[model samples]
Target chain A: MDSTCRRMRAEILDISFSSGHGHIPTCFSVVECLYAAYEVMRHDPKRPDWAERDRFVLSKGHAALGYYAVLAQHSYFDIKEVAGFGAYNSRFGCHADRTKLPGVEASTGSLGHGIGIAVGMALGERVAGRQTKVFTLIGDGESNEGSVWEAVMVANNVGLNNLTIIYDHNKSQGRCLPVTNPGERFRSFGCEVVEVNGHNVDALKEVFARPATGVRAVIADTVKGYGCKTLVDNVNEWHRKSPDAEQLAKLLEELHAPAI
Target chain B: MRRQFKETTTALAATDPRVAVVLGDVSVYMFMDFHRANPGKFYNMGICENSLISVAAGMTATGMRPFVHTIAPFLTERSLEQIKLDCAYNQWPVNIVTCGASFDYAWDGATHHCYTDLAILRLLPNMEVLQPGSRREVDALMRATYDSGKPTYIRLSDHPHDVETNLEFGKGTVLREGKSGVTVMTAGPILPNVMAACEDLDVNLVYFHTLKPMDRALVERFRHDRILVVHDAFGLQEAINEVPGLRTWYHGLPDQFCAWYGTVHDIRARIGLDAPGIRKAVTTLLETPSA
Candidate 1:
């Protein structure tokens, strides 16, 4: 693994322990993907707020610590702010508050809402004659909301070529994975569905490179706990388990090591 | 009254490129002028109320000022989540204009009557609810809403009526001024009933055109003594509850599905909201002083 990716993983593991919960692991895996993407686009010489820059929204805002850590890696904000996660008057919290955080487009915490907000932003950008692209990451469980489908239909109906919706298909939300396949369901809504290994940084990079002409849904098949060997494949209990001293040491060691 | 809204929205859309009017498959009778003038901006988003509001929210986020027109029930209740999250939560300046307030669709059945819209909307943060009593007031409110730059819900009546007094945003208009015995606060099409009930009585008639802000000064002054609230819908009770130190007697229906029946007059009389019912409630309250 590169130094930047390793550093972000370590920061995510540290912040995940702040809440003393295990949900940080899933957040860490996604952040690793985001950090890798940001690194590739660092010296592209494009405007920071360029109309064509790829946009990302964390639909599952409860895992915002992971997002903030990745943003810090990209120098979107000071890295020191990560320590203030969930602290008094901290912008970084369990859920993303758009009002407080820069580059955080929509204020999302209510499930099944982030995708709709992103669709609006994408449509807005398109209507404004901007060629910018929009990407929103939602939890598989959030698909339970009917508004998600409402957004899916709108995105496809309007031919939102600039929008890409990613599903963090961890297969475990609170207790178990939903019985239905989210990717196929998104396809039914007229989205170009892409199923990829969420942990594979290369795969995510490839998916991000292509903006769908008609809404796209990338089903990122990620494990609930991805990094630490013991917790990597564990689905049910690891959704949110705070790391103990021993577990923390193992996670830190694994993060410092090379890519598996 | 409906044509007035269509004309105002159509005129505004002509000059303003950012103005888009979205309807829920029911603009045929209301928005012919707007469609003729600005074909690209006018969209009938089918019968999907949820999608209509969501699309309007999206349009608002992008810099377009969208006016969404539909029936009161579907606009307020059916797609309530979209209204709360997409518009109120985001604080998008989308004008939600409902054409038939309070039994305008009386014959359409119980599902179309939107008596609970005001009550439900008042609970949302940063949403301004307006119930215009007259055609003039409706036009003035619509014009102001286009420039107000706030998330607003303008509840319009089906029939036309005369504006006894000029109505303003966030301020209740005094239709009949009487001594401080008992004040009757009402809104929308029920204003005529309230006016009739206040004639030759020692009761003040305050018409609450705006529902959300609730005119704190007006409420405080009226709250000094006894007050009787005669709302066309059930949700006005929640608004009255915010005022302190007042004996409030609610004159609306109970919090349940309204039974489908005849006109607004028939439903009002059946549910004890007519001039006679309001007169008796006011007279009874004024005759007896609080302990």
Candidate 2:
């Protein structure tokens, strides 16, 4: 892994472990994709702030540690801010604040609302003659909000070709598996649905690189915890758990070592 | 009042290409002139309040000024998150025109009655809440929202009344001046009720059309030891919370869902929002001793 991606992963593990929230593992998987995109954008001087630069929105803002880590890696803001996560007077709260945080396009913690905002953003850019693509990451459970479908209908009706919505299908939100498949639900809304293994970085990169002719929905099939052995494949408990001293020690060791 | 909003919004849209109107399925009956004049700029966003505001936000981002029109309850409560995040947090210069403030939808029952809109919308930052006292005030505030380049919430009464001659944005106008034993502050259609009650008592009548960026200067000028705020909204709790100094009392509905049946007049009479009730409240306040 590159230095920036490696450092960001380590930061996510540390911050999430400190918060006693196990959902950081899910965040780590998404950060890896964001870091890869940022690295490509940084080296290319010709198209900086290019209207076509990939846009990322954390629709599931509860897992914000992952987003802050990735943003730091991209030099969007100071990396030190990640340490202030959930602190008093800190901009880095449990839910993302778009106004305070650089690279965060929308403030979201409320379910089913971000996608609608993203749809509007995408449509606005298109109408302004900008070709920028808008990507929003939604939780599987959050798809239950009626407003999400309201947004879906609008996006499709408006023909938002540059909008891409990703569902972090982690299967569990605090308790049980999602009642339905987000991919199927999105398809019913007249969107192009792509289901893939979310943890596979290369797969994520490929899916993100391919732009849709119309509004697309990507269901990233992922486990709640995909890396650490104890947390890996565990959905319910790791959705949010503060790491104890022993667990923290083991996590630090695992992150320091190379990926198996 | 609703006709004034329609006429003013249409005029604004005609002159400025950046100005657009989004109707929440109710504009078909109200905004005929706007739709006919500016077909390209007008949108029927259907019955979805959430999508309506989101679309307006998008329009604002694209350098278009958007005016969203709907019933007060649907416009303020149903899409509250959109108002907070997309409009207020982003600081978008979108105008929200809500028709039928208070118990205007008296026959539609409690669900349609909007009694808490002002109390909730005023709390949001970068939002200017205006409850126009008459059709003239509605026209003036609509023009102000267009020119001010700020987010505005305009509450319109279904029952139009005589306009306050000297209405100004951000300033409360004195309708009646007297030795201040009791000062009655009100807005929207309730301004007339307060004025009628001012005849018997040594009452000062103040019309508070602009709720946000409140007229603190005017509110501080009253020497009255007793304050009575009469509003069509959920009593006068919100108004009392905004001003300081004298002991305040509210004359509106209690903290309960509005019941089905009765006209706006009947509901106001039942909830003690009539002129007699307002005068009684003012009298009771003047008699009470300050602790």
Score every model by TM-score.
0.90, 0.88
Question: Per-prediction DockQ, in order?
Answer: 0.42, 0.40
The list of candidate 1 runs beyond 4 A from truth reads A1-3, A36-54, A173-179, A257-259, B46-48, B147-149, B289-291
- Candidate 1's displacement at residue B14, Å, is 2.3
lDDT of 1 by residue, B1-291 (tens): 777778777777778888878887776656766677775577776676777787787677667888888898888998788788778887777899897668877777788888778888878888888888777888788777765666888888876567565567778777777785788887777777777887889888877778888877887777766778887786666676687667788877866666666787787787778889888887888778762
Model 1 Cα lDDT, one tens digit per residue, A8-105: 66777776666563366567557645654554332222244444555666777666767777777666788677677767787776677766776666
Ten-residue region with minimum lDDT total, candidate 1 chain B: B159-168
Clashes in each model (backbone N, CA, C under 3 Å)?
Answer: 4, 4
For model 2, residues B60-107, the per-residue Cα lDDT tens digits are 755677788899899899988889887888777788988766888888
TM-score of 2: 0.88
Candidate 2 lDDT score at position B164: 51
Q: How accurate is candidate 2 locally (lDDT)?
A: 0.73
